[model samples]
Target: MTQTEKYIWLLNTIHRSRGRGLSLKEISDKWRDYMAKEKPLDRATFNRWKAAIELQFKVDIKCNKSGGYRYYIANPEDIEDDKVSKWLLDSVSMGTTLMGNLDIKDRILLEQIPSGLVHLAPIVAAMKSNHRLQITYRGFGSYFSSTFPISPLCVKLYKNRWYVVGQCFYREKWQEMIYGLDRIEEARVLDETFKYPEDFNAENFFEGTLGVSLYEKVKIETIRIRVEYPHAHYVKTLPIHPSQKLIVDENGEYAEFDITVRPTEEFFMEMLRGGALIEVLSPDYVVEQMKGWVNDLYNVYNRK
Candidate 1:
């Protein structure tokens, strides 16, 4: 294993042993076996790695002396809760798995995302310098494209597509707008800069909502879904939204989840993902809206 991979493995090992920390011998044996090496991990190298890990990741690896000198990560939950750290770890894990299976790379099928990655760097550069961007954009259904100046606010990725949220002078007033990266025909970072809002949080703007569709008039409401088992298992493991809460879980039957979010079109598609296994059950209007969707589907497939 590479030196970097070794450090990550140690961090992961110590992080996993949260309740009862691992001993030096236990960690060394596991590392040796994992790499299929003849020699076990040495103490001096391990100590160097411990220090390096602390320096690079700012993660403290402390030992419990009274508990047989076992090592554990200090405040393990911090890294777990950090989105950037979690993403880095997960990405590295995937890379390691794929790297080892290069022989069967042809057999591995991956999802195809839109080709808008080229504009990502330029957009990020503008965001970093607090500069404005002049972008030539064409919406999905529109026949014409428009070139406009936008003050970079934040960038988001959803459904394998990237989007940039920016402040633009629209309808004679300044307002925030979301534009898909794919929709951008041409984007250039302008020399002019605009002051970024100090109180603006990119995460908060997208929170309590699913996907990228944003509506100014949409009301945030509590949506309750009755997802039958089989589908319930999947929903429980991977929640539809961050605000998902299990209202009722009937073993071997069904589960009901309460999610507080803006009922956007993308959110509607999520509810329909499970087919008959899912049912929307709350707020008379939301239920009626879902019923209309079902009726529309029924009329299309079962036309008289």
Candidate 2:
């Protein structure tokens, strides 16, 4: 393991031993095999690492100085609720796990994100420097490709596909848009650096929106969905949205959930994912839209 990876490994190790903290000896012993060099983890180095870990990841590894000098993550519950830090911790843990289980690679069946990944590095590099990215993109439903200059802002991964959101000139006017990484044919970082918007928040861009579909004129409204039986259990466990509430729960036979989101194509597709198990209950337009889709499916599948 590298220096950063070793720190992550140590963080993961201590996080696992949350209730009962781990002694320095135990940490060193557990991390022995993961070391890049044969050098022992001395007090000075470990102290430096502890400080660095806290600074880098915003994770506090407090030592029971008065007790056994055992170290543990302070307020471990905070990490679980913290999206960014928690995700980082989980990602590092996965990497370490995969590294250890390399021999069982054949046994692990993993779904892969297909296409347009080659431009990630260049795009990220451009974003880091606030430079523009000249990308040759080929969006869906078009026979031809187009080259354009886009100010690299942020990237998000959803449903196993990577999407880059940025401000770019398109159609006729300059507008902020999302482009799938797979759609980018070629990307190059330009020397001209653009000012990264101070007011624009990346997280807020996708706020109140489901999936990565960006529509200029999105109709944001409350949508109620009726889920029946066992499928209701799925929604209960993994809710469709943060606004989702158990408005009506009757006899465990069915349940109603409310989610306030833009009923975009992606939103409709998410509802459609339930097939016949889910039904749009409110807002006549959305219901009619769902009915229209069901009718189309019925026509396709209903062969007499």
Candidate 3:
């Protein structure tokens, strides 16, 4: 096996052996079985691999001296909490799992997300160096694209799409704007750097909003909704938002839920997608907005 593959195998093996730490002999046996070759790892080689894994993956593999020197992940919580690290591990694990089942490719179906990967590396580099980025972007509704200089702040992923949120110099003032990575035609790291605002917290900035689109002066409020039948069960099992709370569970037919968030266009669209399955219970303004949306839809279809 290649070095990268060996490292991934080692990581996956150790990660799976968490809590039930593995001995050198146990790890070596698994490795041999995985590679389908008897290549026992020496103490020096094992130590090197362990150190490299920690350095590259930020995964701490510690040895328990009392338990006959068994090795396992020392900071699994760190790995779980870090989104980037968790995603990397998940992708690697999925890839490794799929590699072993190549013959059943037809059985596996996956969504093809837009190629936002091209700009991710450059944007991340600019963010790290506190440099502004010159990006050429085209909105879906726009006929022509435009280029602008922006102070790269943070990148976010939502609904299988990547977005870069930053400060854009427009109309003689700096305004916070979000650009879909897929919509960006090109991006260049500018030599001119800008100081990222000390008070700006990317996580907190997005906490009140549903998706990437955040309005400048929108109010965040508690939104309550009632979902009916089977769909209510799904919503209960997999919440619509992180702030979701079960207000009332009317047996099984219907249930009321509450979430504290800004009712943005995306959130409204999500409610619309739920269609007959859900009904907005409170916050009269939101109920009115939903009615307006339904009326618009009705108008479009009812046109003669």
Candidate 4:
């Protein structure tokens, strides 16, 4: 194996071992066996690899002297919670898995995301440098495109698409807007930089809403949904939202769940996607709104 592959193997070993921790001898033996070579990792070489791994992956490999000098990730939580690190690990894992089974490429299905990635590098660079961007963008269904200046705050990924949320100066007063990366015809980073709002947190910005579209002025409410049969089982296993809670008949034929979130269009669309398996149960206005939408669908289909 090459040096890069060896480093990845070391990371995978340590990451899988986790709390158990791996002794120097055990790691050396595994490395020797994995590479199918007789040469074992010497102390100096192992130390060098460990330092390089820490620098490259930002994962600290520390030794526990009291536990027979076993090595483990010092901050596993950071690695798990960090978006960039998680994506890196996931990509590496997927790539390695695919490499081992290249003959079955046709058997596996993958989702295609064409637009978000093309300009990701420049957007990320602009965000890092706190630079303003002159973006030429066209929204869906619009005949004309417009060029505007915006202060790129952060980039977010939702439902396989990337969106950049920032301060747009096109209006009389600067207002926060979300620009789909795919819709951006061109993005040029300006030399002038702007201050990223001190209290603006990307995660918290969309905390009360479902998906990327946030109705900033909308009030968040507890949305109750009644789900029937097999679909309830699916929702139980994979919650619709982080705040989802089972309110009634969890293991029975039907179940009710409560989720505290804004009644955004995306949230309603998700509920609609459940078809006959789910029903909106509460917050009179939302229930009526859903009924109205259903009626509209019926009218469209039943029209002469």
Candidate 5:
């Protein structure tokens, strides 16, 4: 068999093994026995072939993640459906599209997400069942509480992280809540099914908010941001928010933009991460909130 054929066979074998990592000895033994009557593979040749597979895929195939030297792709299944597999592979290959200008390490980590999808299955199952899930979430600013009897609407990916948007019983209304799959310690599908409101539209649910939390009391307001030079170049192509409108200043050598969204904590944290490269210039409340957050950060750091 050619290298491509061998690689396909290898991927199939690994996928058949399920979540259990397969050992090199086991793989080599099986390959040798299975192809003995046909194109026999020697031990040394098999090892080289394995190395080539790992290098081509950029996966830690030989890494000792499962106690011993086991071959495991980031995702167990090398999906055979040409269309679906191509789209999935393309999503990871085109990381910049999913995560804007990610660094090498960030890109590699993002690619590892498919493996983590193993955890997302339960959330999906829960949603399908019309049951609730118990999750511990720590957002960018705050952390606390379990979402009891949360009416799960859908699961989505933003910036390569999986979040389940659902209704919080505590809040007494449909609210867009984002819980990272990795942070979700435990999830249970309740026997009682929730009656998801027919009027609830997942797409428009959090349309006004920057992240997930939406406050009904406040309306989505326009806020302007100024990005200092050099980084301004990054902003031109990759915007901070979809609502952003860019305005270039010839003499200032900087980029200024405005976005209309509910200024939630998550929204403020987005600007905080941008540091000095970007500054929130408008909406007195937003500017004050940013200052308050900076003061809180100073208090925490100054003591230590």
Candidate 6:
């Protein structure tokens, strides 16, 4: 096993020991004996391993001048099931919503995950190794299929679901496909390796837009609205976005705010939801579009 894995096992052991502590000498003796039987580990290697674990895992295995070392369990007597059983159940239930649907085995596996993570390690390893992946994917229309040679760029999490934004070698285009890690039938790293495009930065790619949707060019539109109190309390507590700014208060009665956005469908709906409480008062096109949508909805309800 790697030093990191050994360190984790060692930490687990310290937590399991259930005592005042084990001294550095005691730990070294035990670890040396254990490693000697398995392979070979030097004293320096073990010290480096311990230091790495302390730095990376935020787990400080303290050593006293008296040569006593002890583990500080975040919470003692905290049984896994007793402490986090409800969380595990909720995670599995929520996983279904994120993954759409799953089979019997997948449901069981998902329920077993304490944190509800869909086993990202395998997928991440495949990506890092530059190996082609075999994935079961559902497209935009809920159509499902198994494909063997997808080149992954990065893995992304959106609203609890996991997606791999990558290049589809078979289709010859870059696409972001959501993989239900719980429903992943099988994954095999192919011998053939592919390089991610030097310029493709996932963060840079999806910087804007409310969700995962991507667009070539985005136009920023300034939206001005008037809100009156104490109903304005709603807006005061919740500004639309970080770009929102209070313009002025006319006679200290109502205030105006200017917000800049890409004018997405979600943002448009939010504006409409404000109703008469908020008036859209800028960028003639936005005003016209809102009126058009309102009229369309009105006609739909008014029709015989």
Candidate 6 lDDT over 1-304, as tens digits, reads 4554576556655555554665555666766665555544456876787687667655555554453444333433442334233333344335433433334544555323323254467668878888777666545456565656677778765545655665775456655544555455556666778887788887566554444555546566788888876656677777776568888776347778888776667666777677777777888888887787778878998996
Query: Which pairs clash inside model 4?
Result: none
lDDT string for model 3 (1-304, tens) is 4566667678878888879899999998876776565588778888888888888888889999999989989998988898887787778777777777778999999888898679999999999999999999999999999998999999998888999998998788997899999999999999999999999999898987888887758798899999998899899897888899999998768999999888888888989889999999779998898898889988999996
Task: Give per-residue CA lDDT, model 5, range 85-200, as digits (tens).
Answer: 44444544354233334445544542445334555787788887777776655444556745455667887676667777777755565555656665665666777777777887
Candidate 6 segments exceeding 4 Å error: 1-54, 57-119, 143-148, 170-191, 222-260, 270-281
- The list of candidate 5 runs beyond 4 A from truth reads 1-89, 92-116, 125-149, 171-178, 188-194, 249-252, 295-304
Off by over 4 Å in 2: 33-42, 75-78, 246-252
Minimum summed lDDT over a 10-residue window in model 1 is located at: 91-100
Per-model lDDT: 0.87, 0.85, 0.87, 0.86, 0.68, 0.62
Model 2: per-residue Cα lDDT over 1-304, one tens digit each? 6678777888889999877999999888776666435566778889989999898878889989877999999978888988767877888788887888788999988788878888888988998889999999999999999998999889987887989988997788767889999989999898888999888888788776887886649777899999999899999998887668888987568999899888888887888899989999989998998888888878888885
Ranking by TM-score: 2, 3, 4, 1, 5, 6
Per-residue C-alpha lDDT of model 1 across residues 10-124, encoded as one tens digit per residue: 8887887886999999999987776664488788989999998898777899999999989998878878888767666666666666766778999999898898789999999
Give per-model TM-scores: 0.83, 0.87, 0.86, 0.84, 0.53, 0.49
User: Model 3: which ten-residue window has the lowest total lDDT?
Assistant: 1-10
Better of 2 and 3 by TM-score: 2
Error of 2 at 100 (Å): 0.5
What lDDT is reached at residue 91 by model 5?
Answer: 48
List the candidate 3 regions with Cα displacement exceeding 4 Å.
1-9, 36-42, 56-58, 249-251
